[model samples]
Target chain A: MIQRRPDWLAGYGLLSPAIIIMAVMMVTPLLAMVALSFWTQQGFELDRSFTLANYFALVEPSSEPTYWMGIPFPLTYPVPAILLIKSLAMSLAITLAVIALAYPMAYFLAFHVRGQKALWLVLLTIPFWTSYLLRVFAWKIMLGFNGAINSGLKSLGILTEPLSFLLYNPLAVMITLIHAWVAFAVLPIFVSLDKIDRSYLEAATDLGDSRLRRFLQVTLPLSAPGTIGAALLVFIPTVGDYVTPTLVGGPSGTMIGNLIQELFLKQNNAPLGAAVSITMMVTIAAIVTLFLWLIGFRRLRSRAR
Target chain B: MQRIKFIDRMASGRIDRRTMLRQAGAFGVGLLVLPRLPQAAEVLTCLEWAGYDSPDYFKSYTAKHGGAPNFSIFSGEEDALAKVLAGFKADVMHPCNYSVNRFVNAKVAAEIDTTKLSNWKDVFPALQMASGVVMDGKVVMAPADWGNSSIAYRTDLVDPEYAKNESWSIFYDDKYAGKVCMLDNEIAITIGMMVGGEKYETAAVATGEKLAAAAKEWGTKVVKNSRFLWNDPSELQQALASGEVVAAYAWNDVYRNLKRENIPVAYAKPKEGYFTWFCGLTMLNTGKADPALAYDFIDAWLSPDTGKQLIEGSGYGHANMKSFEISDKQAITDMGITDPAEHMKQGTLLIQVSDAVQTEWNKAWGDLKALKQ
Candidate 1:
């Protein structure tokens, strides 16, 4: 008689591929990055001596600390911290806008649509069909000086000289991001809304809840996980984005991600870039954790149960 | 530099199985004709800038080697350096004067045996002995195409007085505020130094942190007043073409491209002078291809016929002195492609700064681009 297989063996066997991938793709690079952060760059060569210089440089108070839109930083190494703040602020604003815009379209699809739901879902994916870059380029053309909007307005005799302010600013960045990320937000929220049990609404109605009240107590509470997940899906990547900001975020739109790129590539200071990257990642993690804690994630999950 | 992006799109799109098979087929045909010379049978690989991969530049190489060098294209000099340092197995690479030193220091670049290149004597002596090209009495890079990094302005849009005496200070002018774009690189910081009345060609600007704070201040002023920092040469060209930006820190190609389109653009000859730029072929230390054939490819690029097409077709200044005799003289004069050493007296030839000094400038540049105020 054969002995039963070890319980953990098959479990690990099934997970082996994923585990190996995670180890190679994510864990190893992270460990290398962590190791790299401790070293210093001398020209192109890395001085492997372990030192805290890279970390300390972040708060070394060499030059004047920057004040971004009245938010004061009394101490820092002139670059990393402020960009982190700016990126966070921009990503948060984009997340909120995405959620506000996406939820309605998702709600309409999940509840009000009679048939051909796949068609509508496909329509939502049209923006994603091209590329993240092409979409940004389209927006650039539309908002440019002699761009679509300006030319259109000029042809209609609305004004003269074109609106130079339409593109290459924080507002332009926000508009592009909100449009680019809305599709990502919509699908998750739509799934959550679609999965909501109608019987709960019926029960609430029988209990004398109004349509609006039933939505607030039953529907809204159920969709909280998806909404938050969608927010995170958009928020995490956008925070570290360099392309969108660099393209449209003119000088004022310069963010921490661009700084990190400058360090790694142009400055050829991999160690400093690594340190700044780690700091930015930690800062984002802290913000996300605090946000989850503030939202009472455990309670929200348990309530959905 | 501005001429590169279009070629990048083509190279990335077409570096497929078909191109390789076709190139291999050509090499196979070449092997039979020169059965004794096995070096000609082995295919050479060149890492060229995006637009430089056109067949006309390497026609003679193909004729001699039985096939053209298989091309790997890079969009930026920094990218090319990183690839070579990572052991990407390219036999030849094109790096500019500003970056050729990095290759030499890394030991990934070999001293090109200029004697093998029959065309070497015809190359501009100034460029032949340019700072990075001759390091400790070795030809590190085979000089090729070059251009100037100067302001390309909308001739009709700018004030005539400012245009008459074109100055780098125009980037800091209040009248063109939020309407002029500056290059977002070390070039900008150098231009910033120029605007502050410092001579970048001298050691005072590069040796230490003596002018670091000044560089930072000028950077702040130029960046603060300008609309945005441009990454690609095309972005600057487009802004100039549309009249969205009145002036931009642009390459000679942008001015030519805009003028070709009847955009009324002018290449600026600032009072400070033109910042000259030249890029040439550097043989990689990788011995992936036969050494003799690699020199053939460099020689072909230096040929006057290729240089003519290089000047007329792509609109850049080819390095061969004889190339000027064949191309339209008016076009050459319009582009200011005269001897780079001569240009250096009026302005600075952008060479690699010393490592310590570079670190300082990089910091200043980082601050200039990263800082808001």
Candidate 2:
């Protein structure tokens, strides 16, 4: 007659390592950031007073909200809020575009390729072998006014003038991001697509389903997990990316990350930067949670079977 | 051949316990000596910019002390300040005149006892007591090198007459649209303020609203006509050399670099005056190194030979004016100013602006850089 082991204790034992890691690495810093969000900075000194001044000013309208680019009350919102909204929009666009572009690629690798699968996978990761900054600067060299594209065009007599529009734009930013993040997108999606049983496709085909119909009925539903995984991988990091924008986005391409960096590193205002960071993290978390709730992970798992 | 085979087999994981013990013993011996190999000599650490760290500049000190100093560099003064304030110490630090005040006020730097510096009398008078060099009636910074921020232009592309009438307004000229690059710094706003005809004294402590308004107009205007905002000096240098941009808000160093390469570049004497800056050595208060050694390092930096290399190699003005005699005539002539002190009188020296003013400038720059209009 041994004492029965409690289910809760066993579960806690199993999770203790991860729980400790989360508490030390993630939760502690998160708590510190939350506390800092309530503090204020005067000049070079950080005042530890619990106040809402930073949050209030974050949403405060300018004394005179003049229109620029025909947008109404463009300066109505403060710096952090405006940049956060812009970065979110940019990230969403990149996520959707990347996923859409990545799906067919993953499909091809999963189904169409017959030999040297490992070689193809290695080739796909070649861009990542170099430094991320170097890769981004490589894009800068290609897109710059006097860079590869414009120089090539000029030399070929296709264009008399170097194109200024190719670089330092949001379009350039997205292009670089797609290149930077494609491997992240491809691997997860490819793994999901690859993991699908071939018999499912055969079974769907045997029931008089067309190729596209078979893909929709069986293939698409099974690959949802990888697509979701790929989206999170690409979207979460791109929202806070500033170096890409700093190097290639030119004047019109600054993101919230740059503002947060300036606030913390340059302006001696860690509290405000912390507030911005917390706000951004919460916003992203809320949006992702809402998305998961709408899609229903349980539904995805059941459908995969 | 049998021994080689045995070694290869050992490497391939076929080693016996005895062989493994031998390999481990070899590694242990290697590790014991590795830390003392290259740096057995006493290191005199100097924190400075990219070009200043070379052993060539510290030859006098090295010749005297029997070893070269260790080098660490910071891209900007703010970064250097942050590092020093966070207790990163060095024997000597190079900060511009405008930023040395922050180091003084923060007590991150110690006062320089000028009597110890051998070349103290040879340094130019203007730089010796320049803003932020002196604190509590003692010199805290020994002036080393100086330069000006002005338009560096392709003489082959832009007309000499137009460039001669230079103002910061050249950055706003639509004639150079999609062909101009400006520095991406808070100092770029100073150029804007200069072109806008704002008084420097007033602009340094302007209210946030006033700063916002002024920067919105002037900063936005500069960005509107520019092709890109360059964070690194080399970017503008490449752009100018490649004929991508005809003109850029560049330093005298860029002018020197292009001229050395025969790239037909010139530093403009803008009507609004150049934004002059001075660089010098500041002794770290928290430095664990010998004070006398630090003073020797500063003296070496200000010595005429080091100053010669500064003028000829780096293309920046040295505080020891006698270095001008040692510098090549062509190099001095190509720089367009033999006397830095005289040139400084014709320009404006950048001073430390208040924290509030800096914050507003940073905000305005962020907003303006992102705004399409």
Candidate 3:
């Protein structure tokens, strides 16, 4: 006797177009970028000599002079090194701030809100429909000394003078990044939360687990993947972002990305810029790997139980 | 069951062979045609600083020419150079006088034909001959606009008495340290070199040791007190309006815009005189040559009408002699160039620093920034 065959191959044949597009558009550029990071330029010409100078420069700080008193101090610390440290600090701060603010909102949308999950999700994504540049500029205007927020506060007699600290500060950069990336942090967590089966919570309750215990065990562990994914999404882009820091970060808020721009655009130093880019990529990759490892470890432990 | 199996086998065998051949043929045709497709439009892109090619000005040029000239705006000369070196094919670029020599030495710009520019004679001869333009008897660039690197202060926020002094000392004064802003530009920082009694070429070629010492001392005095080191005029304007910064190093147009907006900001010609940057248009030898169109564009931009428009719109003093006559003298004076020739003499062109010296400047700037932390 013989049997009939499945028709899923036809569907896969249709998907080949999309698969080819991904390979060419996404994978090809990534491969090209990796190649470019290793390449160096000399004067008006690009040199094909494979060198680690670019990578070294990224990891090593600039050898520029450090001034002290009337004496000139030749400081070993390079700009790239400083930028790496600064970018990491700033990106981490932003990630933590987003997590702190977004987790609760995601929680509310997942558990507290009923029959309006889609509505709130759409609302969360509304800000993204506007131009990113315009959104950042809006923050600039709102935080301006005579801007709406300051003027509003003054009108309410809550402050004596318009706050000077509102704009051109690290605080402003943080605020803008948080607002810009809130949806990025929230959606993933929400999706994870929504996927949790209600019967599991009921089972936990039947097992005499308290609300906090149930959340810690079932909900938090289950949501770990989403939370980690959200962090990686936000942290990687924020660390290398130049516009946000330039527009709102002021002098104090300038980041490694700004220096990389200076190298690539201002200084006309391709090798140095590539070095900076590669350095950032490596650092971010290491951090992301560590995070994924932790997540995997937790998953394994959960599976073992 | 036998009939059903035989039918399934027939369908699978027929479809699989047909699909495989079709996919192979499609891939082969795509591979052949993709490389043959024509590239995007050829543009004589200009990498310029802001205010050089604002929409209002470019729109008129585009309207007359039937198309807009492509402009890739950059905030800093270093950034512009980096882009240029990284395979950006801009036919024309606007690097300041100081960096022109470097561009020329690096063979970035082609030797320009001065005779092609009809309004060449109308440019202020001194500015036209600024250090970056005529290198080794080759006219590299046509000077567009020249101005002093002076301070702009908010009269409404800063005491009139303090600002009335009209000296560079006010910027370094402890009284205004936390309320002062400086331009985050090499040219603006070079003013500190002048104030420290170093000449343009000397500062340009200053060793890492000298630069580090000067920058450290300058940094210690100013960085902490600096309310902001701004890249854009708009940022400076915001700082002035908010009282976060009472004074700042700025170009003339920034102050003009503030006054126009009723912000009461005033520009002063410091007693130490002001450092100047003269930007010029230079042609690049992109593999595809368009010398005629490039020359036509250059001449059109230098025409008295265009020059006058730039003066009126950008508030930067034009180098074109014909523009001085065509532009409103009172308006020109209001923009702070009372005597264009005298102002040109007072202002000095920025010179390009060699790699060795630039390393020093970078180090010093980094240390200065680090001091804040």
Models, CA RMSD each:
10.2, 7.0, 5.2
Instruction: List clash counts for every candidate, in order.
Output: 0, 1, 14
RMSD of 2: 7.0
lDDT of 2 by residue, B1-373 (tens): 9668755554454555555467668878989887664545346677887666777676799989988777777656665666665467677889887777777766678888898888999888877776667767778888888888888888888877776587677787777787788877766666777677876666656666777777777777778778788756777788899888889988777788888899988788787777777879999887777788898898898998988887887678888978888888877876667666776776787787655565666666666765553
Error of 1 at B112 (Å): 0.4
The alpha-carbon deviation from the true structure for residue B326 of candidate 3, after best TM-score superposition, in angstroms, is: 2.6
lDDT of 3 by residue, B66-150 (tens): 7767888877666666676667778887876777765676677899888988879888777776667788888898877766667
Q: Which ten residues in a row have the lowest lDDT in candidate 1 chain A?
A: A1-10
DockQ of each: 0.25, 0.20, 0.30
Chain B TM, cand. 1 = 0.77
For candidate 2, give the lDDT of residue B290. 78
Error at A305, model 2, angstroms: 18
Each prediction's fraction of true contacts recovered? 0.38, 0.35, 0.23
Per-residue lDDT of A4 in model 3:
35
Model 3 DockQ class: acceptable
Best by DockQ: 3
- For residues A194-285, write the lDDT of model 3, one tens digit per residue: 89998999999999999999999899988877888788888999998889878877766778888777666555555667667766888899
Error of 1 at B232 (Å): 2.0
